[model samples]
Structures are given as C-alpha cells and as structure tokens.
Target: MHSAIWTAVSLFLIVEGLGPMLLPKVWKRGIITLISSPEKLLRRFGGAFVVAGLVIFYMVNK
Candidate 1:
C-alpha cells in the first residue's frame, strides 16, 4: 500500500507538471486565469475533483 501510494503520487506529480514543462506560456496563462477565479469556486472545483478521484480509486481497487 505504501509503495503503491508513493508511485501514484509520483506519477500524478509528473502528469501535473508536464503541461507547464511543455508549454510554459499556456501554463502561465492558465495559472493567471486560475488565480483570478474566486476562492470558493476553486474550492468547489477541487472538492469535486477529489470526490471523483476517490470514486475512481475505489472502483478500480474494489
């Protein structure tokens, strides 16, 4: 479980970083847009994504 979690985190980090590494300008624009969004809106979006990720993880593990 520990190894699996670590590997998953590593892969997620790589995937999250790829867009910025490949297209810095677009990534910067996206960051600027995100920065301009309301805090509540970002929190809600983050909550939704967390729920979705948990559901997918449970489904795959089960």
Candidate 2:
C-alpha cells in the first residue's frame, strides 16, 4: 500500500512538473500572452490542483 501511494505521488509530481517547464519553451509567446491576462485564472487553477495533490499525499502518508 505504501509503495503504491509513493508511486502515485511520484507520478503526479513528475507529470505536473513537466508541463509548466516544458510548455513555456514549446509555446513561448503563447504562454507569455496567456499569463499576462488580468484574470490569471489558469495560474490559480493550476495552483489549486498542485495544492490538492500535495494535501492528498500528505493525508495518505500521515
């Protein structure tokens, strides 16, 4: 069970980490334009997902 939990956490981190790091380079101008918006909803949404994932992992492990 612990191994499975760790595997899931690791996978989540890897998948989430890759996108922001990779996508900006691939779509440099587009990413810049998107982030520049006054609303910035996407950043907030992504941050929420990351926080939720971390919280889930913490609860499961603890």
In lDDT terms, which candidate is top? 1
User: For residues 1-62, could you state the per-residue lDDT of candidate 1 as single tens digits?
Assistant: 89999999999999999998999999999999999999999999999999999999999999
Report the number of the highest-TM-score candidate: 1
Q: Write the per-residue lDDT of candidate 2 for residues 1-62, one digit (tens) a residue.
A: 89997988899799877866878566677668777866768778789989998899799779
Model 2 sits at a Cα RMSD from the real structure of 5.8
Error at 5, model 1, angstroms: 1.1
Quantify how close model 1 is to the true structure by its C-alpha RMSD in Å: 0.9
Clashes of 2: 0
How far out, in Å, is residue 23 in model 2?
A: 25
lDDT of 2 at 16: 71
